[model samples]
Every structure is written in C-alpha cells, then in structure tokens.
Target: MTKLTLGVSSCLLGDEVRFNGGHKHHRWLTHTFGQYADFVPYCPEVAIGMGIPRNPIRLISTDTGTRAVDSMNLTDDYTERLQHYAESIVPQLDALDGYVVMQGSPSCGMERVKLYNKNMIPEKIAAGLYTGVLQRHAPAIPFEESGRLSDPNLVENFVQRVYVYHDWRTRQPWRTAKELIDFHARQKYLLMMHDYPTYKRLGQKLSNLKDIDNRGAFGQAYLVELMAALSNIPKRGHRVNVLQHVMGYFKNQLSEKEKASLIHSIEQYQASEVPFIVPVALLKHYIFLHGDQFPYLMNQTFLNPYPEELGLRNPI
Candidate 1:
C-alpha cells in the first residue's frame, strides 16, 4: 500500500514553531503512524509571519465574529492573515489524504479551541482559524486533532476515513455508473456498521443512476455524505448487527459448535467483555475458512478497514 500523504501541524512534528518556541511532538504520530504515512507539516502562524518566541495568540469573540488576535494586544489581529495562509495552501492541501492538527491552537486546532469574549472568559468553543478555512474548502478530507488521537476509536475512525478518501481520490471510482455501483458495493457492510440509515439512503440514490445528469456533482456530494456518515463511531449494537449479518452468510456451513462459538463471541463483544477485535478476529477466521463460498463477504471493507498492525481495534 502506498503511504498516505497527511498534513500535520509543524509543532506536532517537532518543529519549534510555537509562540514559546516549543514543539508538541506526538510520539505515536511521528513514530507509529508515521511508519505508514508521509507527513507535510504546516505552521500557519509562522507561515503568516509570526516568528517563533513571538507573542501568543488566541481566539477572541469580536463584533464581527471570532478572530485570532494577540493575547496581550487584542487589537493586533491575525485572523485574516491565518485564513489567507490557509487559503493559499489550498492547492497543497488538496493532495493530502488527512490532517492532524495541534490541539487548542489559535491557528491549527480542529475543534473546541477557546473563544474568549471581551471579559477574557472563554465564552465559546470553535475550530482554529487555519483549519476552519481548510475544512470549509475541503470537507471530505479527514481531519483529526493530535490530542484526540489518544482515543483508540477516534484514531481508528480517522485512519479508516483517510484510507477510504485516499482510495476514492486516487481511484476516481465514480466515472461511470457501473464503477460507482462497484465502489458502493465494497463499502456496503462498512457503511451499515457506521450508519445503516445513510447506507440505505445512499444506496437509493445510486439505485437509478440514469436519473443523474451530473456525475461529477453527484459523486462529490455522495462522498461528502458518506464521510459524514462514517464520522459517527459505530455503537456496540450496530457492530453486533453487522457481525450477525456477516455471520448469516455461513449459517448452513458452520457446524453447531462453530455457530455457538461465533454467537458467544458476538455476545461477549455486545456485553463489553472484550474489545471489538476479539469477535472480529474470530469472524475473520471463519471468513478465511469459508470465504470461497461467499465471495461478496470476502470483499466487504468492514472486515479490514485499515491495516491491522495499527492495533486500532485492540483498544476499541
């Protein structure tokens, strides 16, 4: 597999670009995930001419809206500059499969950055100035905060989305109705695991592709919706449902003992007695044993969303 190209905050990559000239180097991102990805670092504040060891900035709720301004001198605003820097990098950012931003950054945080009112109290929460623009420009790209990556589920979800988006971007899989159908077919079970209602609705849209005149527009919209649906982490009940659905494919082939064992595994997962990987591993074992008879099940992306070596499912 080609290494995913990811945009990351320079600080997170150990660049001393912060206001205090410190780096927020993330070990897992640099040493672990980095093994499977190539990083493109960005420091919007530095790019916008804020020198290292400069005065810190923060989000301020202004009369116009939230603005990035000097923490000590609120009148010295950098909102426009940060936004412009982000816009200038649109072409570069378009090539990235995903992004990992520095948390609580005035220029790079993905979410929950502090927004202070005139009283200096954090009155609101908002995305960082730079990332906000980037997200608005390209909503489909998977963006995760370095802080949030500590959560196993969020890490898995982000990596899964990145791989899916990269596949769609690189493969350009929606050129024809048949290609679109095949792409969606591969994602069917994966979509069901994340959001069944969206799975059905998206399927309905593609049911009669003859009605669609603009394939490009339809494809873009479909991807945005699909990524949005996948952003919701699958609930335990949803996973159990998907697991059972996959299990149904081998109902007759499995012996009574095998069936009972699979049922017990699913029940254990549902009851929170084990991590999601336990049952999934067992299911994959069965698939390996009997997948030749059920080719469709063999092709489901839900079975192997991302590289297993990441150990993302272990914690989840």
Candidate 2:
C-alpha cells in the first residue's frame, strides 16, 4: 500500500525551527505513525522568514483586526507575512491526506490561539493564522494537534480518517455507478460508528445515484456527506451497537454458547470494563469462522482500521 502523505509541523519532528531554537519533538509521531506517513514538515515562522532564536510572537486584537506581532516589539507585525505564506502553502497541500499542527502557537495553532486586546490583554482565543487559512482551503483533510493525539480515541479517529481519505483520493475519477456504490458499501460500518443518522441519510443519497445526471457531482456530494459523518469520534455505545448489528448477520449460525460469550464481551465493552479490542477480537473470530457466509462483515473497516502495532483501540 502507498504511504499517506501528511503535513506536520517541523518542530514536531525534532527540527530546531522554533523561535527559542528548541523543538517540541513527539516520539510516537517519529517512531510509529512516521512509518506509514510521508511527512511533509513545514514551519510557518521559518517559511515567513523568521529567524531561529527570534523574538516570540502573539496574536493581538486591534481596531482594524487581529494581528500577529512580535511580543517584545508590538510594532513588528508579521500578520500579513504569515497569512500570505499560509495562502501560498495551502495550494501545495492538496495531495496531503491530513495535517498535524503544533498546539498553542501564534502562527500554527489550530484552535484557541490567544487573542489580545489593544491594551495587550488577552481577551479571547482563535485559530492561528496559518491553520485558519489551511482550514478554509482544505476543510476535507483531517487536522489534529500533536497534544490531542495523546487521547487514544482521537488518535484512532484521526488515523482512520486519514487512511480512508487517502483511499478515496487515490481511487478517484470513478467512471461507473458500481464503483461509487462499492466504495460506499465498504465504508458503511465505519460511517455508522460516527453518526448513524447521517450514515442512513448518505446511504439514501447514494442509492439514488442512478437518477442524478452527473456522476461526478453525485460522487462529490456523497464524499462530502461521508467525511462529515465520520468527523465526530464514535462513542463506545455507538461501537457496541455496530458490533451487535454485525452479530445479527450470524444470528442463526452461532450456537447458544457462542452467542452468550459474544454478548458478554460486548456488554463488558459498553460498560467500560474492557478495552474496545476485546469485543472486536471475538467478533472477528466468529466472522473468520463463518467467512463464506458474511462477506459484508468480513470487509468492514471497523475490524481493523489501522495497523495492529499502532494499538489505537487497545486502551479504549
């Protein structure tokens, strides 16, 4: 399989590109996810001609608007420079499947970047100028902060979206309705875990693809809905529900003892007594045993989204 291209902050990869000549290196990013990612690292400050060991910058709210300025010398505003650099860089990021940004940076933070008032008092928070521009340009690509990846659920969701988006992009220019339907069908359970109602709505929309005049338009519309539905982190309850739905396929095949064990494992997961892997393992065992009977369940992404070595769902 082709590695997914990802946009990452240079400092996260141990590059000494920060203002203080230090790096906020993340070991997991370099050693684990790095293996599957073709990381394209960038530092907005450096890209905008800021020198290493330079004065720190902050976002300041002015009568005109919010501006990024040197904290030491408020007169030195790099707002336009940063914004212009971000605009230029966004075009090149079209092929990236996702982005990983540094947290709490005036130039790169994705959310809650401090915004100061005219008196230099922080009054509110907003996204960093570069990330704000990136969001506007490529809202489809999943964006997450390095800090947030510590949460197992967030890590799982982010990686899942990245791989799925990469697959969708690589298999593009769908020439026939069957290709579109097959793609949608393969991702059915993955979508259900995120938002069941949106999943059903998307299914209905996809089912009517034949009636639409333009297949490209139909595909784009469905892609938008599909990504939107998978944006939210799937709750444990939602996942348990999906597992039960899978079990329904083998309702007549499984023996009474097998059903009891499967239900017990699922209930344990629902009650937070065990990690998500427990129930998933049992379900996969049954699916493998009855391989010829349940082709749909066998192809579900929920069974194994990312690599097992990542252990994204082991904790939750």
Candidate 3:
C-alpha cells in the first residue's frame, strides 16, 4: 500500500508555531504512525498571519455564531481570516485521507473547544473556527483530535477509517457498479462490527445498481454515510457478534478442540478479560490455514483493517 497522507496541526508535529512560541509535539504521530504516513502540517493561526509569540485566540459565542478572537482583546477578531484560510485549502485537503487536529485550539481544534460568552465565561464547547469550516466543506474525511488518540480504540478506528477512505479515494470504485459492490463486499464485516443496521442498509442500497441515477451523487452519499457509521466505536458486544459470525464460517474446518479454544478466546474478549487482538489474531490464523475454502472471509477488512505492526488493538 502507498503511504497515507494526513493533514496535521503544525504544533503537533513539533513546529514552534503556537502563540507562546512552543509546540504540542505528539511523539507517536511524529515517530510511530509517521512511519506509515506523510504529514502535511497546517497551522491556521500562523497561516492567517498570526506571528509566533502572538496573543492566543479563543472561541467566543456571538449573537450570530462562534467567533475566533484574541483572548486578551476580544475586539481583534480572526474568525473570517481563519475561515478563509481553511476554505482556500480545500483542494489541498482533498489529498488527505485523515486529519489530526490540536485540541482546545481556537484555530484547529476538532471538538470540545471552549466557547466563551459575552461575560468572558466559557458557556459551551465547539469545534475551532478553522476545522469547523473544513469539516463542513468535506464531511467525509476522517478527523480526529490529537488528544483522543491516547485511547487505543479511537486510534484503531481512526486508522481503519483512514485506510478505507484512502482505498476508496485511490481506487475510484464508484466509476462502475461492479467496482462499488466489490469494495462494499470487502468492508461488510468491518461495517457490521461498527453499525449492523447501517451495514445492512448500505448493502440493500447497493443491491439495485440500476436505480442509481447519478453515480457520482450516489457514490458521494454512500461514502458519507459509510464514514459516519464507521465513526461509531464498536461496542464489545457488537465486535463479539461479528467475531461469532466469522467463526461460523469455520465450523466444518476446525476440530472440536480447536473450535473450543477459539470459543474460549472470544469469550475472554467478550468478558473483557483479554484485549480484542487476541481473538482476532486466532481467527486470522484459521483464515490463513483455510482461506482457500472460504474466500469471502479472507477478503473481509475486519480481519485486517490496518497494518498489524501498529498494534492499535492491543489495549482495547
């Protein structure tokens, strides 16, 4: 696979572009995941002419909506400038599979940034001005805050979505009905694990290709819904359900003892006694040995969503 290209906050990449002339420097992004991806850093604050060591900005709730303004001097608003900068980069952002944003930043935070009211008190939480515009313009792209990557489940989910989106982007599957259906087939189990209802719904939608009037519109809408479904972190029960479904395929292949061991591993994972990777690894072993007999199971993305070397599923 080609290396993924990710849009990242400049500060998170160790660039001293912060208001305080410092950096948020995320080590895992720079060292580990960086091995599989090339970072395209953007510092909206700096991009909009806010020099290093400039006064910090914060989100303020105005009568119209949220505004980015100088924290100390709220009169100096930068909302329009930040929004314009994000808008101008729409073409550049299209090349990225995902984005890692700085949390609590007025310019780049993806979510839960403080939104202060007139009395200088934080009244609510919202996305930063820059990221808000970008998300609106391209809702299909996977966006995760740097702070949220600390959770193993979120990390795994984010990376999975990145790979799926990248594949779709590069392959342009929607060009033909067969190509689109084939792509969906590969993602069936992964989608089922995240959202079973959506999984079934999307399949039904794709069942009748002749009904699609505009392939481009249908494909874009399909991807948007698919990404939204994938955004839901699969509950342990949901994962167990998918695991059992996959195990069903090997009913005749595995001996009684082997089947019992696989069952035990799944049971341990379901009960939270072990990490999810343990059972998944066992299933992969069986799939490797018996893949020729069950080609469908071998192509499922749920079995290998991202590169195993990342070990993203270990903690969850």
* TM-scores for every predicted model: 0.96, 0.94, 0.96
- Give the local distance difference test score of model 3: 0.90
Query: What is candidate 2's lDDT per residue for 121-238, written digit by digit as tens?
Result: 7844789988998888777778999999998878888899888888788888887787888888888888888899998898887787773458876776776777778878888788
Whichever of 1 and 2 has more TM-score, that candidate is 1
In angstroms, give how far residue 92 of model 3 lies from its true place: 1.6
- Cα RMSD (angstroms) for every candidate in the order listed: 1.5, 1.8, 1.4
Candidate 2 segments exceeding 4 Å error: 215-218
Looking at candidate 1, the ten consecutive residues that score lowest on lDDT are 208-217
**Residue ranges of candidate 1 with Cα displaced over 4 Å:** none
lDDT of 1 by residue, 1-316 (tens): 5789999999999999989999999999999999989999999899888887999998988789989889889789998888888899988876889999999887888888988888889843899999999999999889999989998888999999998888787777466787877788889989999999999999999997863467788888999999999999998899999999999978788889988999999999898999889999999998999888888888888898888888888654
Report, for every candidate in turn, its global Cα lDDT versus the true structure.
Answer: 0.89, 0.86, 0.90
- Candidate 1 lDDT: 0.89
lDDT of 3 by residue, 233-252 (tens): 99899999999999997878
Cα miss at 247, model 2 (Å)?
Answer: 0.8
Ten-residue stretch with the least lDDT total in model 2: 211-220
lDDT, model 2, position 72: 97
